[model samples]
Target: MFNATECIEIQVKSRHALDGRLEAAVKDLQETAMRSRTCGILITRHQPGHYTAELSDQVPFGITRELCR
Candidate 1:
């Protein structure tokens, strides 16, 4: 079971300095979540990857217009 009450907005950037891209990403996410004190993470990426993970649960990818401002 999962709780949806808490969340964090995560922005992912590909850095050349990090070893093992995917591994670094997961570690970074865990560290950021601990420091920020959040549960759910809304992840966005600055650089496109060769592969992408899609959610089976019908979460919208588009942001609300009000939030665009």
Candidate 2:
């Protein structure tokens, strides 16, 4: 339902909830992004500061991280 764009996969999780759910969370985000034809996706935790992770598509992880940051 949405156009593909270069963006990170942002997920919010607390200090406790984030444990043992990284794969599921990232998979969900990737699935959602794929449905929307998203160009890329990045997985990160919920925190007060900036963070970056690997991207799922052609775009480099660093570039996506920089753009999101």
Candidate 3:
């Protein structure tokens, strides 16, 4: 669960295969959330080469979730 007002969402999209961009994006967002003292990070794969990273208060601190759909 995420509160819209307290959640920060970042979208990552890449066209190339075998690129590490997605992982890098996730790491970056996680670092940012930690620095901001936010709750945790959520990563969702919506499609090929597309992902959404979210930092929100609903997630427990120091936790991360990788979801695929």
What TM-score fits each model?
Answer: 0.29, 0.35, 0.57
List residue ranges in candidate 3 displaced over 4 A: 1-19
Ranking by lDDT: 3, 2, 1
lDDT values, one for every candidate: 0.35, 0.45, 0.63
Q: Tens digit of lDDT per residue, candidate 1, span 1-69?
A: 223433333333455433255444445445544543433233334344332222211333231111111
Give the C-alpha miss distance for residue 28 in model 3, angstroms.
1.5
Tell me the tens digit of each residue's lDDT in model 2 across 42-67. 55444533333444566542223323
Query: CA lDDT of 57 in candidate 3?
Result: 67
RMSD of each: 10.5, 6.3, 4.7
User: Which digits, one per residue and each the tens of the lDDT, describe model 3 over residues 1-69?
Assistant: 334344334444545542466556657766777676757777777776666677756677788887889
Candidate 2: residue pairs that collide: 9-42
- The list of candidate 2 runs beyond 4 A from truth reads 2-19, 45-69
Candidate 1 stretches with Cα past 4 Å from truth are 1-19, 41-69
Summed over model 2, clashes come to: 1
Q: Please tell me which model should have the higher TM-score, number 1 or number 3.
A: 3
Point out the higher-scoring one by TM-score: 2 or 3.
3
